[model samples]
Target: MLILGAGQVRQALDGAESEVVEAVRQAYRLHERGLTELPHSVFLRFPDSARNRIIGLPAYLGDDTPVAGIKWISSFPGNVAAGLERASAALILNSMRTGQPEALLEASVISARRTAASAALAAATLAPAGPQTGVSLIGCGVINFEVLVFLSALLPELDTVTVFDLDRSRAESFAARCTARLPGLKVTVADRVEDALAAHRLIALATTASTPHLAVESCRPGTLLLHLSLRDLTPETILAGVNIVDDADHVCREATSLHLTEQQVGNRDFITASLGEILADDGYRRDETALTIFSPFGLGILDLAVADLVRRTADHLGLGTRIPDFLPG
Candidate 1:
């Protein structure tokens, strides 16, 4: 077995945002071709801590590059108070031919980057044409930072970013980091959530809130809202938007944004389209006059895609720890 560490993964992913986005697009296409199986993620809850939960997502990606992987990610919202990230993850990739464990890799950066890449890809695919003038980032954290990096690539016209966070220092720090990473982009720390929402027509939500909520009354009509934090938008907000999800069955079931919307509205038909269907040339039309929301439940195919890339790159560069053969020949 080969073990790829975080540093190697980060090195392999550097300046590869466009490639990752393309991989996500191809994964969606594979889904359309009926070559993938992504079941709803399974959650393991902690008995004592309300904020602690671990998720297990398994996926199989078929076609020429056959592969399978599982992402084990844990979320502890309280970790931020202790100067730690709210989420951490690892992925295990297996050989498709023999179903043997091939590699184990750190997934924190991989997960964040692939997710942001997918969001950027979706925005490029569905958002209105023209310069991407402004964007609002709801959560000023690691994920949102990476999201900005990917968005900058997809929307080169992107010049301004409005940021909001409950913690003022965090928001300021995030803005500073953005300015350093994306030299030409302007980062403004908004005083309030509404202020951030009202300033930008393209909004990205990456908060840890499990409930259905966000104050966006001041948001302009036809704003493209990327609900990267799963269940951040209220059902009323979802109903008012041209809703798109990564998967209908997985996201509209029990604990995701679509699921919360279904519980609130008492219907599942509110979803307009799935990413796969949209990529498949299904008649999924966008309502230009309506608000748009894209909620992806964080598909495992993305994890697999990044893992495949890292594995190949690490193999070529000899970057991982190759374990001695445990199974005797």
Candidate 2:
């Protein structure tokens, strides 16, 4: 077995945005082609902590080089209040040929990177061609931070960003961090969610809002909304848009913004198409008169794909610890 720590995983993935996005794109294609199996993510919630839960995602990506894995990830929003990261994760990858556990690796980084890659990939696919000079990020969290990191590669022409968080200080700090990481980008802290939502045509929503808050009128027409957090928009707002999701069944299960839209409408007629379908074909057209919401339910295959990449890269770079005959003889 090979063991990869968080630091090692980070090192292996550093500056590999293009590769990671390609891997995520392949995973999406595999899933769309019915070459992947994804069980609904299992959630473990604590009665005492309504806002926190741990999720287990099990998936198999079938292709010429098949892979299977499970990601165990925990999210504790209060951790940010305590000056700690709000999420942590671990992944166990198994060899498809022998059914033996091949590697155990830190997964929070993998999770974040894949997520950012997916969002960036979707943006690159759906967004209109022009100057990507401005973007609005509605949540100043780790997820959006990573989104900006990938966007730096995916949309290098972005010159302005406006960010907002419930906690203004956090938003300000996020801006400072972005200014440092992405030079020549003007990062501003928005005082209101509506202000942030309206700051740019390309909007990213990654807040931890437990329930619906955003309304349909918050954004202008033709807005490309990356609904990363999944629970930030109201049912009416979700139904009012041209929705694109990673997976319809998965996104509609967790009471995400899109799920809420489904619950209210009693159908998924509003969904435009899966992101994979759009990525697979260049002839797909976007309705520029409507708000385009891309709400990804965070697929397990994405984690498996990114984790496999990290494992192979680490192996080539001699970056992880190898444990010989640890499972059984």
What local lDDT does model 2 show for residue 298? Answer: 95
Worst 10 residues of 2 by lDDT: 212-221
Candidate 2 collision pairs: none
- Candidate 2 C-alpha error for residue 167, in Å: 0.7
Model 1, 269: alpha-carbon shift in Å? 1.2
lDDT of 2 by residue, 1-329 (tens): 99999999999999999999999999999888999999999999999999999999999998988999999999999999999999999999998888899899999999999999999998888877566778898889989999998887988788899998989888999999999998889999988888888888898888888898876576777889999999988888877788899999999986787777777879999888999898788898777788999999999999999999999899889998999988978
Q: Each model's TM-score, in the order given? A: 0.96, 0.98
Q: Pick out the ten consecutive residues of candidate 1 with the lowest summed lDDT.
A: 280-289
Query: For residues 1-329, what per-residue lDDT tens digits would candidate 1 score against the true structure?
Result: 89888899998889888788888888888987889988778899978996689999999999887999899999898999999988899999988888888898999888999889888987887867456778999998888999999999999889999999999999999999999999999899999999998898899999988777676688888788899887777777777788888887778865766787787778888888887778777455556667889888888998998889888888888898888784465
User: Candidate 2: lDDT of 112?
Assistant: 93
